[model samples]
Target: MKYCYYILSVSLLILIFSCDDKVDLEQFIDDSEELTLVYSSISPQDTILKVRVLKTLSSDNNIEINNSDAFVIPNAVITLSDATNNSVRLSYNSDDKNYQIEATQLEILPGATYFLSVMVDQREFTSSCTIPNNAVTELAFELTDNLNNAGDLKESVTIRFLDIPEASNNYIVGARIEDDAFDLFLDFENRRFITDQIEDGALLASFGFFNNNPDSVTDITLQVANVEPILYDSLFASYSNKENRQNPFYEVIIPPNNIEGENAYGVFAGFQITERLITYQ
Candidate 1:
């Protein structure tokens, strides 16, 4: 597909904070309970499934403290089964902390139901959802015809959504781009940075880059997650008010485009309960 070009300016700033004066507290604290796995492909209609695991801080009475050392279930074994019960095992990538069932592992026919079974730390978690028939989302990137006084490419690209509701308050957003000729998932914390409220029935944002050669964009894809009804409503207010200035999101710089050909990008968006979402409800 041919990419589009646009010109815009985007600026990023880093803020730091500090606290003083401490109160005495207990030296020992109990660890939080293991997170329960909530499995589903980011898009129910696609064979390329994305799964998420989460646990609430208040779920277990024995677990009282906040946060845990283990963000991801290590060495977890995950399997995906189609409507016919044919299954395939997903490989766990420690660096990304996700059990990825590649597109080649299973052929997802439109309208088929897929089940995901996860085993981590001796606990079993299972869930299933149907994939939608339409395309999950599309991403495009291009260089602006405009140039700075120094003759550098001054351009920005806005990844847009199709068939996504503009009034939808509940969603998680993510994106993946081609790196080293392979699709590398962007870190969750970093992807959160690009996230913002979808106002007036549409979600729109822009990212600016400086380059002498505008032909360097290999690929870009944006993904949106499902927001549970309750959590979705809360975000409508929180994001609208901007109560927290902290950008839980992250931005990664992709080195000049080294990949070639109609390079493809993937967006992984899913619905899973998070501690914040659970507690707020």
Candidate 2:
């Protein structure tokens, strides 16, 4: 039996795209942290719509996470709605193992806010986010001749984006170097969560990727998302807590969720993503 497996790594705290994080879902089956995880993200550029609804397992359960009968939520009343109250009902497609509606069925507006409601059994989960306008003024990749601390020669990319002018604007930036199946994500600072609270205007960020042999690199991808402020806070707190998790003095902190309901835990946020690809120079 095949199941739609979406990997969410608690240890690495990976959000999405250009990442390869490995973790056994069964290992996180502690009864204490058990809950329903409804994860979804929307983009106008998507070719297929997808969403995940999963139930965590108990410590005593020996069933495999993927093939478990009770793991996936087969019956769900999934709906996506806008502020004006237009809604689209999504059905569980067993072929893809997710509740989805074809992209052709609905017209999604760029930089527009939308809401998600997932009804499972007697409970309902809800969350929403605004897609960013993605008006980037300047996006350039810079490669330097200087060697990194490891003495390995490498290249870096710098992005200067016209900040989304909002009262409370927040973003998640990710960069990775790729060549076919192999991907080298810029670590030590992967997926930097930032805000424009202190900014006067526009923002700039940079990341370096391993490139001992420049010919081995093909292209670099930069994914910049103007995520919701609520989603921004949750992601920031989650990674911050990871640093202190080993400290005996610190209390365990479960990252806050935007989804509102009993036994509902996870994010249903949309991404207004602006991706730029730069060929190795």
- What TM-score goes with each of the models? 0.42, 0.74
Local accuracy of candidate 1 as per-residue lDDT tens digits, 1-281: 22221111001000000011111111111323322434233333334454444333332234323223233345667787888878898776665445666666777654466666667566665655544343325444333344444575555333334334543334444443434543233222222333235444354433333222324435544444443333233323323223233445633222121111122111112232111110000
Q: Give the TM-score of candidate 2.
A: 0.74
* Predicted candidate 2 versus true structure: per-residue lDDT over 1-281, tens digit per residue: 22333323232124345532322343342235557877777767555556767776663565655554557778988888888888888888786457788866656677788889888887888988776555344456566543556786556555556676654567777665666654445542433666677874656564555534446667767666666665666667666555566798987556567788887777766656667887866
TM-score for model 1?
Answer: 0.42
Worst lDDT 10-window in candidate 1: 9-18
Model 2 residue 256 distance off true place after TM-score fit, in angstroms: 2.0
Model 1: residues with Cα > 4 Å off, grouped in runs: 1-33, 37-69, 136-281
Model 2 clash pairs are none
